[model samples]
Target: MTGGISRVSYSGMLLLGPGTLPLLALLALPLSWVQVGKLNGDVVVQCDTLEPHISWTLNGEQEPMAELVAEGQNLTILGLDLPATGNYSCWAGPVLLDTTYVVVSSTYEEEMDVTCQAESYHGSFHCSWPGPPSAVFRARLTHSDGSVGLWVPVAGGHGQFSVSLADPSFCPFGEELRPLRLHLEGLSDTSYLSLSRHFFLRDIVRPDPPQELTLRWQGEQLHLAWAPPASWQLPKSYFALLYHLQYELPNGTQVERFVEGVEETQVQVGAQRVRISCRDPYTPPAWSPWSPWQDLNAPQ
Candidate 1:
């Protein structure tokens, strides 16, 4: 967890230091040695050369060569386990040849409880998932046309990880041709896990609450007015919202009403308090959280 691969080139030999390796192998080396093998399975780390002076070390220490099968340039590890997972460096007469980071494939059940939400249809959204405390997660979005996005590093701790992604091709006014694919990978020092999800943006839309709510008294009736959330898409005719109004009567009775295509309404007075929420009528019927309650008699 605290080791990374730092490469320095001197003369012609490649030098690498022990440090944390990234979930994805991005280090530039003479040969790619990052391998993920099944637990208890056999793994072979081969050097680029077949020199007779070839030697191997595990985690900067002298590996028990006698316990492993070292034939010419090939080092074969049998019954791979957690203790066998680490950086395996090949050496030739004090000169570093190459290093291979070996990891075991996790056998734990896949975690699919990932949640995602978008405030608007602007193509950007955030997703979060629960994972092991020692795991590091990275995510990427696969576009509708089979194009894969870059792997975005997740940020979180205490068994949770989250990342934000966007698709520039998303259009709020156009119908979705295909669902977006999310790919996630969780990596630990000794093991790794992967999960994926497919969903349309409309299913996860959850806009912010309505704004600028006002209540005014006109004779024996109360007039209420509010505006859609600023974060919602523009062109009210194209991106319409449905509002839910609720109030409690002085006698402790609650009344609810739905308003659409309008932002102002009048109701009979004597209501103790009033509140409102809104949602897209065409979507999956998920309403935004209710706005704060406003007392009917508190300063207009």
Candidate 2:
């Protein structure tokens, strides 16, 4: 009764009668400070004072003595489960001491639905995951140099959560000593879950598609030109990218070509359309999504 209560309404007339009022009241109790415990683990709730006659109540009812262990100033909850989660209050002879809203840590089969990506190897990356609609999440990074980062809160909507993180010491040109570790914790009003992933920045790199693409004809030779993705790290020599060019011929035949160490290339004449993608050459072979197709005669 002391916590916040949910507002409820009855129909135009009290068809259920007054006997149901008590049940409705019991379901509207407000929650207080949260205390999360591991599933199936014991949780000890203590009273601040050393009163010998202390007693406890859960959700406005007498605590279930058979399912718990009671000692002076402390109550030990056993085998935490969903049914064991509720507001627990400590009392001493008509005086209220403290209240704790206990919940258990849990996870579902979809808890590991996480994905990460880096646009460039300059050390910043982003990871996202799908979770319960009411959940909040925080993330941290463990860099290749063995340094850990502070928790970074995530932002999301419609059941998806994401966070961006950066490691200041990361070098785009240096060899990686270890994979970076990403740790995530998801919390809800009645439950908590945690997950982790590990990978090198280079492995997760998915550079933006090649930009400013153009086609020119000099007599019989057709030339293709494009600039590296703007998001890619500067100093092209230190952080080179490999490009893939795909085109369609007049006979409906498709041809793909790999262009490395340069952003411009010569292609066979009579190609009708073209698109290009790029990737980090030193990392695992993963190409960026193809750029939008460009028709040869559409315009410059």
Among all candidates shown, the one with the greatest lDDT = 1
Clashes of 1: 4
Model 1: per-residue Cα lDDT over 161-226, one tens digit each: 889999877888899989999988766556666678999999999988998988777775678889
Q: Give the TM-score of candidate 1.
A: 0.81
Residue ranges of candidate 2 with Cα displaced over 4 Å: 1-38, 51-71, 91-96, 107-111, 298-300
Q: After superposition, how far is residue 119 of candidate 2 from its true place, in Å?
A: 0.6
Clashing pairs in 2: none
Worst 10 residues of 1 by lDDT: 6-15
TM-score of every model?
Answer: 0.81, 0.78
Model 2 lDDT tens row, 1-300: 112211122112111112122335335533224566777777877777767788888766784532677788878788777667666778987898876656566656254678899999789988888886666677889988899998777888557889999988898878888999998866554565667888888788899999998888766678989999999998998778899999999999999999897988887777899999999897898888899998876323
